[model samples]
Target: MKKTAYQKELAIKATQKREGTDNNKRDVMKIQSWLTLFSMRNPDSGTATGIDGDFGPATERAVKNFQSFNSLTKTGIVDQELFDKLSSNLKEAFEKPLVGNNLRSLMIEVAENHLKQHPFELEIQGQSNSGPWVRSYMDGHDGSPWFWCMGFAQTILDQASSAIDKNFKALMPLTYSCDTVGNTGLEKGLLSRYQKIRRDPSLLKQGDIFLIQKSRLDWTHTGVIIAVEGDVIETVEGNTNHQGSRNGVAVMKRTRSLRRSKIDVFSIEPLV
Candidate 1:
């Protein structure tokens, strides 16, 4: 079916709103994904190659096609107007539940249970006049190494798999190293792993492991998926000392709009 005038206008608005971001490439990928979902509903709206979370030729073409068909400038760029239209159309699609499988939710529950079984002391780092250091458990001695983010995320993924009586080898393998920071195993960038996951949400489950990028340029953080609600994703991360809080886990609610802030998600499924 042909797209209605109202739908075209909405897409234009959404595209316009997506402009001017430090992570323009990531944003473009998200726009493409949203566009793909939109096209799934109004099959004649235009074709999107799907959200690979990367800005490539296919995505550029889709943007231009969408703009031209909507009577908007064919700049091949997504702006607020286009984004708004896409958002409106997607909202309508979401009203119809696709299919709800609880595998992801089940993974989250298992992860939580595992954490309870092997809870450990969480140490907070403090800035000293010389350099950064952790408060010693006994003082007057070198503090212990703080729990690394990758290890923390991996433990949850591993434990969740075990709780469900699944073989760990069958699940996605996770590896962490200092050199991997700012790299997603795809290219050189801080927190590249998380960016890869964000680009492909279809591969993620509720309890998947994720590495959260600390900043647009610095991919130095990690986290886990606590929940997924349509376009909104909730994450539980460690080492963000915010709101007068010390070393512990913190929850962040993110929307599809924040593209530069990437998260690497590793999905796991049980063997039948």
Candidate 2:
């Protein structure tokens, strides 16, 4: 399977940052962000570094510590070799090869690939919905108002579509807003309202998109349905945590009760 173009560019940009001289702030920030994310994921990797875009003594020390933890030379430099190790999680999620017989199964496969990477949101300098994963999914956009559940859902679809040599944008526009996706589903006659789905849960197939309906015309969150059993649906979703709030953080595999919250399904049979 071909890697997503956004991550390829991000990987290139990350490798461009060589140490020793005054590094670009944005590049440095990327390095620091990755370091912080790595530390957050692996507590023993190194001390948590700040994403201040400064390659100062603290950042250098953190790099050295990270290198030491990874059993590498403590060079304290963010070189191509070092970046490959630092950003491996991102690469695995967006670049790893996957296979499936069709779009529906392929989307489930793609979503699982990302869930393995444990993507999550970061608050950088008091900015929410901010991080490398969010940026990649949002097409280099992240922050407040960049709620990325829809972006994550679309990215999974995009990767699956690319793998199958199909255009996912034709099924649903590449967007970050849940309302846009829900609206498009309604317009395309792909939306299965909660009322109808409650009566016939079979209408929701694995790999179908789920929109958290706020009312007749608004959706607040989105995710991919991975399984359906009676009133419960298993989902691979982004920007949510244990409580399952729409604004929570992390890429999670969650089980939601269909009878509890209002949800609408967007069928992907059109793509299949």
- lDDT to native, each model: 0.44, 0.84
Stretches of candidate 1 exceeding 4 Å from the true structure: 1-103, 114-144, 169-203, 214-218, 241-260, 269-272
Per-residue lDDT tens digits of candidate 1, residues 46-154? Answer: 7556554555667777777777767778776666656766455323321222232344554455445433322222222332110011111111122234434454454
Question: For model 2, how does the per-residue alpha-carbon lDDT over 85-139 read when each residue is reduced to its tens digit?
Answer: 8888888888788869799898899899999988978888889999888888888
After superposition of all CA atoms, the RMSD between model 1 and the true structure is: 20.5
Sum up the clashes in candidate 1: 36
Ten-residue stretch with the least lDDT total in model 2 = 9-18
lDDT of 1: 0.44
Best by lDDT: 2
List the candidates' TM-scores in order.
0.38, 0.94
Among all candidates shown, the one with the greatest TM-score: 2
Question: Can you list the residue pairs that collide in candidate 2?
Answer: none
